[model samples]
Target: MSRPAVLAARLRTAAWLGWQIEANWADPFTFIVYSAVRPLATALILAVMYRAVAGIASSGQAFLGFYVANAFHEYVIRVLVGMGWVIVEEREEFETLKFVYTSPIGMFTYLWGRSSVKFVQASLSLLLILTTGWLILGLRWDWGAVRWLPLLLSFVLGLIAIVYFGFFVAGWALVLPRAAISVNEGVAAALTLLCGVIFPIDLLPRAVQVVAMLLPFTWWYEALRRFLIGHGASARLSSFSDGALLAALAVSTALFSCVSVWGYGVLERRARQNGKLDQARLF
Candidate 1:
């Protein structure tokens, strides 16, 4: 196929696969209960904590904003990380990895569809949390048109990062017979701990903070905080800066994604050569 033809085909495949994954989104009650619960609880806890602190000191909206942004961002991360391992779920249930290995289109396209759908599903939770907090709790919205561009950029970047990370997990599952469990929980826990979810990295010890900075999650979270909070509001073209940040993040995500996907392909192909692909099964 011509290069453009191939690209179009991949995109179509991605769309089809994305729709399939989305169709499996949790049922109404499950979606509401699972997606909204944690963030709602977190928001409430932060509200009380902030109210206590503000009682004795000057009142500020920064904490409220930061809490909402970080909590929402963390939920995004959860979606990204979890989507990475869904391939394993398929492998365990019906040996779908073999089918993926033999598929006509590139694995990346199929994976993109699946992960993108899952990301949307996971993000739904945050949407509920943020909207409820913003409208019901009287949290202020900055209402800046252009200044909020970075927020969208960060979200896109975070999504891309999840795809790259998912490649590593999928590759591990392909190469190591029983590696999916560790890949799933290990990546999830490591990201949650290091991504400034529960606490910002600045509050951590110097050494731990340095290590956390090396991971992609920190950058994702930091960019999210800046974008959602209108970091460049003082600038004349705050909206332009927001767009620029989004563009930069998009490029970075593409670069990392290429590297990670290439690495996974290499490992998966090698596993096939050695008859180790079957080891990916749970049984």
Candidate 2:
């Protein structure tokens, strides 16, 4: 087979493997129910907490809209972290790391395919959550008024950037399995707090806001809110122009991809050389 054909074949197999991983664990109905229910429940808890702290009435349409949009962004972080941790789960729980490492399909390709499945699953969950928020929490949006082109562009770029970020974290699973979960959680929390998932970045300390600007997800979320809700949703972060945001996304994608590839290659080589593919270690 040609190089491209071989790569395509591997990706197809990896995708099938990813699908089976989820499908074999639960029926379609159960999967759908769990996905929808879990995030909605979490959003409710978050809403209550916000209302209590901010003293905002539940009936306030403005707060509801902001909360739902933030919650949706939070869901994106959840998906990214979950997909990244799957590598650790496969190695530790499923005991498939050795087999996977020995397979002809490369680790990068396998993870890419698996994360694609996660992206689709997360997208569905986003829709369900948005619907539930609209019906139950009275979160209102003029969906028809949204700028479709910019919204779609931001979503696509954000998704790609986040997936690469996940892959970068997945590399840690290979080298430091014990720390993977903690590291993943920490990264998720940092991104959530810094990327304005639940509030405007300006609400954070100025130093933190500066740090947030260095992260790709900050620009992605800003662009998303701007496009989806309107300029007012992200007007506070006026430092980032649309062109700058797009450039940041592109640079972030490239950087994370390079890091993930290099890190995975290093870990894989070490594991093979030391015959530690199945060995559990902290370092």
lDDT of 2 by residue, 1-283 (tens): 9999999988888778777776557587877566667777767777787789888775465465456556556445555786657777777777787888788887778877777666666777777777777788776667887888877887777777676667667766666667777888888878878887767787888898788777777777767666666553345666677777777766776676567567667766765676666865532
Clashing pairs in 2: none
lDDT (Cα, tens digit) per residue for candidate 1, span 182-233: 7777777777677665455666677886766556556666567565654421
lDDT of 2: 0.70
- Would you give me the overall lDDT of model 1? 0.62
* TM-score of each candidate structure, all chains considered together: 0.73, 0.85
lDDT of 2 at 283: 27
User: Candidate 2: where is the Cα deviation over 4 Å?
Assistant: 25-33, 58-71, 232-235, 263-276, 281-283
The TM-score between candidate 2 and the true structure equals 0.85
